[model samples]
Target: MADEITASDQIDEITDQQFLRAVTSFEAIIVSQIQVKNKLGDRLNNAIRAGIIILGIIAVSLLILLLTLSSQIGRISNVVGAMNQDFSTVSVQMSEIDTAMISMELRMKLLEGIAGQTQVMDQEVVAITADLETMRGTMAGIKSSVKGVRGNISNIAVSIDHMNVNVQQMGYDMQRMGRSARSLNKIFPFPLEY
Candidate 1:
């Protein structure tokens, strides 16, 4: 009985020591699991922060690009308006040019009519010059005939002066004869006056 009791007491002491060791091992395991969970949580937080920073940079770049595109579109609209105004000015100038061309065409037609009249006038002038040449030849013959007539008139004037001298001599002879006849009548005593 005493051997059995000593054996029973040793068994009880061995069971108490094993229970303390098991409790210590369980506490160590729980502490290690908590540390691992904390480390994972820290890593997750760092990743989230880095992702937020990258997303912010991308958003800022997109906003800048949008603003630049809007400004370019506004400038393009202004240029288009100016181009429309220039096109309107060009159209007005073209209309004026068309009117001028029409006026020039009418003037050209008038010039053509004047040119035809000038050609006819030139032909008439040439015909008149030919007629004048013929008249000049006839006038030359008339001038020669007038020169001969002038010489005949001079000869007739000289003959008229010679006849006047002879007439005066005859008148003197007649007067002498009339005096002789009167003396004879006085001697005869005939009445010649009756």
Candidate 2:
């Protein structure tokens, strides 16, 4: 009976030891599984955070590009507007130049007409000068004729004075001859020598 009782006690002690070891192993497994799950969760969280940061950077870059493009578009619009204004100004200046050319052409035509009139006037003046020279020559000839007529009149007056003096002498001689003839006839009236 003592041997049997000793064998039972030893068996009971062995069983309790085995149960404790099993429980310890199960607890160790549960702890290891929990640690592995925590590690995996940490890695997943890091990857998700990295992906979000990359997406944010890309969005910021896109926003910056949009801003730069808008600025460039504004500068291009200003250049186009300036070009349009310059073209309008050039068109107006061209019209003014055209008007000035037209006015100059009109003035040239007027000058041409005046030049023609001046030519005709010059020819008329030349003709009048010739006519005046001819009149001067005619007047000179008339002056010479008048001088010759005055000389002839002076000679005629001198000849008429000489003729008047001869007439007076002839009248005196005729009276004396008549008186002598009468006296001779009376003195010789009684003496007739036969």
Per-residue accuracy of model 2 over 77-96 as CA lDDT, tens digit each: 65556555545555554565
- Per-residue alpha-carbon lDDT of model 1 for 44-136, expressed as tens digits? 576557557656755665565556556555655555555555456555545555554565565556666668687765665565555555445
Question: Candidate 2, TM-score vs. the true structure?
Answer: 0.52
Candidate maximizing lDDT: 2
Model 1 clash pairs?
Answer: none
Each prediction's TM-score versus the true structure: 0.50, 0.52
How far is each candidate from the true structure, as Cα RMSD in Å?
A: 69.1, 72.0
Q: Compute the lDDT of residue 176 as modeled in candidate 2.
A: 50
How many pairs collide in each candidate, listed in order?
0, 0
Alpha-carbon error at 94 in model 2, in Å? 2.3
Task: Quote the lDDT for 64 in model 2.
Answer: 55
